[model samples]
Target: MPYVITRLCTNDGACVEVCPVACIHTRPGAPQFYIDPDVCIDCEQCEIVCPVDAIFKDVDVPAEHAEAIDINASFFRQNKAVVGPVAFETAWQMVQRAHAYAASVGIAVTAAVVDEAGVPIAVGRMDGAAPRTAELAVSKAYTAAAFHLATADLAAQARQPWLRSLVVAHRGRLLPAAGGLVIFDGITIIGAVGVAGGSATDHDVLCCQAAFSVLETGGH
Candidate 1:
């Protein structure tokens, strides 16, 4: 079976570096290294050096992380599929007209840009964030992008006991505050940005401002 890097893979590159057959691709620049299953010999050595314990036998991937499996499989498509896009900008450049548009603001927040399919195109976690803050920020951005709605809007909708119940029923962690913005470019949901390390409203506004700035300046 072709060994797949599930969500457990943390981009450590240990597997890529250790492969004796050199089947795993280890080019100078690539998003989290990948193993070319077609070239791999199923050696268990890769399982040894991984620091994050991310390696998994192909059949062991859980249902919740199935998308990772699909991502790996699709990389072999005859026509290269678009992975995603991300560009960072100065706070003002990203959120243009911020001084005029928003009165109350919060700490400078990092932003993530995602594609239509809810895959990250780019991510930026501002310096000094808590250890897991990056992951939280990305998750919020993805949540905003997938529903094509602002985080605040979702929060508002969830305020209804029934709606909140339904959201919880689906096992969604929809926070009711701020910190995420669904990006739109000329009626197309091009991406989303989410901010953490601040109040819900603060984070939401920061991300929204960034989204607007990106729209004005042709994206970042």
Candidate 2:
């Protein structure tokens, strides 16, 4: 049996905090907290606190959300990937990690943290975060980390006369400059963090730092 958090959940986190066994991994900083079905007790407490009415039994899981069942399963299986051990971290934690650095630099920023597959896992906006800025941050981050190539590195490598033509063709689509970082567990790329409204270079550094913080701080 599986328990799923549906689209109706507003990510308020009340349900996440209430679980007795802590089967849920909804860290305070995650974008959307989810329950590991294998760990759930089929308890309805999560369903009880959800303000947006998003929780549901896996048996009654919506057709659109059916994929979540598999996602939950994949989350629990212990495995060693090229990077290292696979672990799940919350999106909120990712943003907070990046925000700590951005704060020091006096940059008000927002972030959209996502999985390697380009799915949004968490989104956060600091004071005055622009919509376009948030979007660009996510886009650039995804482009950089998904291909496992840094933006600047890519641009420099592309500068060869032969590759320049290819670079020109791709243009802005291949933002290898900075401002993005991979979210990973050991060797596995679990997700990514992107920040905007600051220097691209600084944002990039913070993005990575924040993601790493989640792993270190354990999503505080």
Candidate 3:
């Protein structure tokens, strides 16, 4: 889960400097900083550097500021990709569209889609994809959905001691590799797309990017 910036934020911007992904944002006149959940890798660097001790993990948010969890998430929901709620059918359509794009480019790949809860909604492997491609795709999709960040971004975070400990704590649930992207409806992450069986990480990222583009255009 992502961390929450509480009211105690002193506007020091210390957390912002330590964040490798630069997920923290603030304006000159703003009272406090905002951490974009979609971009945070949950590396806890901000938590370690906050002079005011204002940052808290989503699940550990104080009772008085319990609303901050939703508050942080709602900030992203302002511009939704779909007018209505995302559903299983919509997730499936996204995977199908990604598969089609991969095929068109002559890249046989496996793709997986997972909902906001990191539950698998749809998965597919194009003909001639590696046998293990489906499993890798699913793991990548789950990681993106659970962390609310692209797997490529996570690849860097995975090198951190805290992040590596998290991987051990989760027992390998988090796969920090390329080819996974968070699917945003506007700024709110609705799901994630993951692709595998490409010639390299860059190729896998390309296929996932195509899928994200479809989501960005509202599946057009």
- CA lDDT, every model vs. true structure: 0.56, 0.62, 0.78
Error of 1 at 174 (Å): 4.4
Best by TM-score: 3
In candidate 1, what are the lDDT values of residues 61-131, reduced to their tens digit?
66776565566666544323444334445323443333223323534344555555456665555554455
Candidate 2 C-alpha lDDT tens digits along 1-220: 6578764556677887766335565445545667765446464667777778777888988898887767555555543354421233467767776777677777777776766655667777777666677777676566555444444455454454433443355454435556666655764566666666775566655655665676676662
* Candidate 2 least-lDDT 10 residues: 79-88
| Candidate 2 ranges beyond 4 A from true positions | 1-89, 158-174
TM-score result, candidate 3 = 0.74
Ranking by lDDT: 3, 2, 1
Report the C-alpha lDDT of model 3 over 1-220, residue by residue, as the tens digit: 7898988888988998888656677667867887777667677899999988999999899898787777666655553454333566666677777778778778889988887767788888888999899989988988888777788987976778977887787678778899888776656667788888887688788888777665567662
Better of 2 and 3 by lDDT: 3
Error of 3 at 41 (Å): 6.4
Better of 1 and 3 by TM-score: 3
Cα deviation in Å at residue 54, candidate 1? Answer: 48
Q: Which stretches of candidate 1 lie over 4 Å from their true place?
A: 1-108, 159-176
What value does the lDDT take at residue 146 in candidate 2? 47
lDDT of 2 at 27: 47
